[model samples]
Target: MGFSPDSFYIKTLGLTNTDDAEIWEYATTNDFVIVSKDSDFHQRSLLYGHPPKFIYLRVGNCSTSKIVQVLQDEIDIISQFGDREAESILVLS
Candidate 1:
């Protein structure tokens, strides 16, 4: 996938237990997009909007491989979404 390591949630970043607000702030400051199944970010996007855009995974219970496959299938859509300045959150299942 040639993605340039934008996500900062690995254990090395020490964000394993960080709250949403802190994660939100980090993404905003660093121009990172937050991708998760957590609906908190969806609510946040509704209230705040843009800058640090988000991708909400409505993919109920599934393995990481399944999620990865979903993302791979939607790579074009995701790319288009990333390019759209007016778009903020993308809900992928």
Candidate 2:
């Protein structure tokens, strides 16, 4: 997906490096979803809640082309997941 610098809290906050908790705080405050391969965010979502939903990619290391294709194919599902009230995390494999 195309991301503008403004779309990332890290960039907006002028942060070069930050911890997960900080990132979580930024996302929650800004109502931005967290998309990552790290399971940390997934675990955090389960413990806390969703204002900042999480999208976890379960697929193993792959080419960028393949990743893009998978995302493109699942765009509909992703969009629907974002709208789910009770769901905090969406795992895409």
Candidate 3:
């Protein structure tokens, strides 16, 4: 399932250029999954565990299309990861 930034108050709350902590807090409060390529989120996931689960993309320096393709290809695995109770961080390489 695709999510619009507006649905999570990302645009409404003016989260542009905000720090990771604020974004994390919002995600936690709203029960939204964090999908990012940033290691900061990955580290936070490792430290805090979950209420806001994280999907860390390990793909290095690629075009936006490639990134989207990778995510599309792995949607099934990603869905499973999101649904799993014990899993919080999904590192997609």
For candidate 3, the TM-score is 0.83
Instruction: Write down the lDDT that model 1 would get.
Output: 0.84
lDDT: the better of candidates 1 and 3: 1
Predicted structure with the largest TM-score when compared to the true one: 1
- Which sequence of candidate numbers ranks them by TM-score, best first? 1, 3, 2
Q: Tell me the tens digit of each residue's lDDT in model 2 across 1-93.
A: 343333453555675478999888888888888877778988998899887999888888986567667767888998899788999988888
Q: Pick out the ten consecutive residues of candidate 2 with the lowest summed lDDT.
A: 1-10
Q: Is candidate 1 or candidate 2 better by TM-score?
A: 1
TM-scores for every predicted model: 0.88, 0.79, 0.83
The residue ranges of model 3 lying beyond 4 angstroms of the native Cα positions read 1-13
**Candidate 1: lDDT of 46?**
81
Task: Choose the strongest candidate by lDDT.
Answer: 1
lDDT-sorted candidate list, best first: 1, 3, 2
**Residues 1-93, model 3: lDDT tens digits:** 233333343455689889999999989998888878899999999999997999899999987677778878998998899789999999988
> How many residue pairs clash in model 2?
0
Of 2 and 3, the candidate ranking higher by lDDT: 3
